[model samples]
Target: MFGVTILGNNSAIPTLDRYPTAQIVTCNDQLLLIDCGEGTQLQIAKYRIKRGKLRYIFISHLHGDHYFGLIGLLNTLNLMGRVDPLSIYAPPELEQIIQIQMECSGTALRYEINFVPLMPGYTGVILEDKDLSVSCFPTQHRISCFGFSVELRKKKRKLIPDQAKAYEVPAAYYGKLQEGADYLRKDGLLVKNDWVTIPPEKGKRYVYCADTIYDVNLLPYLQDADVIYHETTYLHELEGRAAERFHSTSVQAASLAAAAHAKRLLIGHFSSMYTELDPFLEQTRPIFPNTDIAEEGVTFLV
Candidate 1:
């Protein structure tokens, strides 16, 4: 279930059909919300994303389109009587902003909110739990913004059923064998785990380049990622406007993905001026054939 669900893909303003920038990264059973833009909660409901499964939220910057829905989402969770704790990783100033909102409304959340501040120019692994690990890197945005790379670790060894049976190992012990544990026979003979198992396969990776200008420095973080989400706020014709606004054009996003050798590229965060999104793909696919518009409610498997 390693995939990304696009909740809102539009930029700054919320249009009649398009919302803002928000997405859900589904890593197995865990769900991570990336950038709670305006109308995020409604999008979640429309998409039928299990809200209780959401464990973490990552905000790219302090931009209104990126995190304006945080307070609303939190309030909704509290109103629903949710008691599970939630974690948020964002710029340091967001903590104060959220605190002020909570104070003004006198709303005491039922669940614990753990706010992890992402300082300026910070880049490192921020979380590691079970089979999931997430790292953050600085991006070239108007404000201090960051991109996230989520990796799903593969820990279990591949078991050879034929070899295990050759050693007369019981079927009940196969689980232990996959954990790299030696199997002991009834006669006290040990069957080495390596004889029946191979090393685990490499894990899958997903990179989210949240709201940033076209920059080649991001290649290192996006290298060989199974799926990458890069903002394409405008078409190629508006390349100048994109650069002036610290946003990316369709061609720029595809170029970055091609340079990084990413398996798939998901482009979104389209400007409000564009009513139809077909031109984005028409322009980007020529540069990077794997590029796809990050359509709202569509989940792209990583």
Candidate 2:
């Protein structure tokens, strides 16, 4: 169930056919909402996502298109009588913006929100739980922006059944062995945990490069990702315009993914002026054949 569901792929404006930038990453039972643009709640409803499982929100920047619907979503969760605590990771100014909105409207949330502010020029691990690890890096945008790297780690150690049985270990205690606990024998002998158990399986990594200009420095974060989502706001022909607007072109995004050796690339945040999205794929796929369009409501497994 580790996958990313695109809610709104369009950038800036919400056209009749597309909304703005929003996505939901499903990490096992938990859900992470990234970049709550306008109409995100409706899109969530349309997709029938389990809002109750949503535990975290990650905003890339303060642009209206990136976070205009955040306050609304928080309020909706409050009105829905949510009691679970929610954690948010974003720029430092987001706290003030949320506080002002809550104050002006006289709204008190039913659930607790823990906001972790991301400071300028910071690039390091922000979260590490039992089953997940998350880090953030600065992206080249018009304002202070960030890209998130979310990883789902395997928890249980790999057990060697043959070795365990050769040591006369019972199957009843296999679960404890998988939890990395030493086994005590009836004759006062001991079996070390690592002697019969191997390391856990490889983790699944997903990186979201939220709105950035063509920059090679991001390769460190994007390297070897199971899925890398990069914004392709324009075609290669509009390279100059994309640079002026601090956005990326289709070719640039694909080139970065190829250079980083990411397993797959999801390109979105398309400009509203473009009626057709085929050109984006046509230009990007030639460079990176494993690229996807990041279509709305479509989930890509990582």
Candidate 3:
């Protein structure tokens, strides 16, 4: 159930065939929308995503392509009569911008919206819910940009059914046993928690390098990720332009994925000039064989 769905993958401009930048990360039952570029609402509808499941939004930077659709999406949520609280994580200025837009239109949302700012040069854990934890780190971009690392944790203890059955433990109490509770027999014998269950397994992680230049400092943030989405805004031949613009080339993205030892790499945020996406994959696969295009309308499991 934990995966990422690409909505838009183009950078700087929106073309008929490509979009700006947007992604939906499904963390179990909850959905986190990242970088709501223009046409994001239409993309969501085209992909048939369950909008009601969306609970959080994360914007990497203030670039128009990264957050232009935010206000529209928020308005749509209000139009849908949503009452659940929505939390947004973004740079400090985004809150004021959203508020101003709302006020200018004399619009009020039906649901409560909370804003959590990612301060400049800040890095560390920013969110922790019952099943997931999210951390943010600065990326080398034109503006004050940040990347997100999401870890989905399993809290329940692993149940050993055989051990429980051997101890004459009833199935009715299995749920409690998984919660690390001790069992007491009718004869007053105590069944220790460890005798029938083990701690939950380690969680899996998905790291999103929203938009960054070819900077190796990001390796620490992407280390050992289950899946990583890094921007490859240009082909290897355009490395100079990419560096000058504070965007990454295909080779750079793959190199980072290889260095981080990530299970797989999803590259996108392509420049509008490149009508063909094959070059991006061709350049990255040679460096990191697991690299794949972050194709819109597709979901990648972490």
Candidate 4:
């Protein structure tokens, strides 16, 4: 299963009901944390997310709202006897920030933390496994920031059972055939893997646009994404204010998703001033019919 669970959706100033930016991308049993805001660990527990499966953490920027809870989470994981090494993808400055906090507190982690720096203006694949791939690209924000693109893909080709049976390929060798291996029988028959299988469909993509102002340059990454998550920190009436803060309005986010032809649009990073979220949907739905509020604890399957 490939899905994103919203942990915290509010912007910098967290409200009573909403929190700062944080999300969990679940790919099968593995979990990737997109951002760690204040009280993220508590939210994780509230949502019943499996902390043991969390393998990677991606911080969009150095903003306190995005990563202030990181050290606390690390401490809790260590106390809970977590031994697996974790990887963090973030700006280079975060490495020092984490180190300084750990140093001052005399806290030495039992597990190793592999830090992969996402330098300014850098964009490329950061992590790839058999079932998932992740990449990061720059986003226009108040500071140096990045947006992540997560793709869930199958490594094996699609298997055609009828063709395999007609070729006299044993059922036991179906797995190997799907792995693109040809087979030779004792009767001197060569069965090409392509004869029984075809290439798998393109991977499903979920692009998180992080914190950014209205920028058309992001269309390449958002193009035809299964789901695109963009920040709508303000309503359409406050477009000028959003631009001043380097944030996007509800309409702007929907417009980009419509232009990119994204299948679904998830808008969050809402301002704390507004209590009700319906207005945001009301503003975006007309521009892009398929839009959803990034409600806390709700999982959006890709």
1-302: candidate 2 lDDT, tens digit per residue: 79999999999988899889999999998899999998899999999999999999999999898999898999998999999999999999999999999999999888999999999778999988769888999999999999999999999999999999988889998899999999999999899988889989999999999999999999999999999999999999999999999999999999999999999999999999998999999999999999999999999999
Q: Residue 265: error of model 2 in Å? A: 0.7
- TM-score quality measure for candidate 2: 0.97
Flag regions of model 2 displaced more than 4 Å: none
lDDT of 4 by residue, 1-302 (tens): 99999999999999999989999999988999999999999999999999999999999999899999898999899899999999999999999998998899998888899999998999999999777999999999999999999999977899999999999999999999988999897899999989999988788999999999999999999999999999999999999999999999999999999999999999999999889999999999999999999999999999
Candidate 3: count of backbone clashes, pairs at least 3 residues apart or interchain: 0
List ranges where model 4 is wrong by over 4 Å.
none
Model 3 segments more than 4 A misplaced: none
Candidate 3: tens digits of C-alpha lDDT, residues 1-302: 78999999999889998889999999999999999999999999999999999999999999999999999999998998999999999999999999999999999898999999999989999999988999999998989999999999888999999999999899999999988899999989899999999999888899999999998999998999999999999999988999999999999999999999999999999999989999888899999999889999999998
TM-score-best of 2 and 3:
2
Model 3, residue 224: C-alpha shift (Å): 1.6
**TM-score of structure candidate 3:** 0.95
**lDDT per residue (tens digit) for residues 49-148 in model 1:** 9999999999999999999998999999899889999999999999999999999999888899999999999999999988899999999999999999
For each predicted model, how many residue pairs clash, with residues at least 3 apart or on different chains?
0, 0, 0, 0
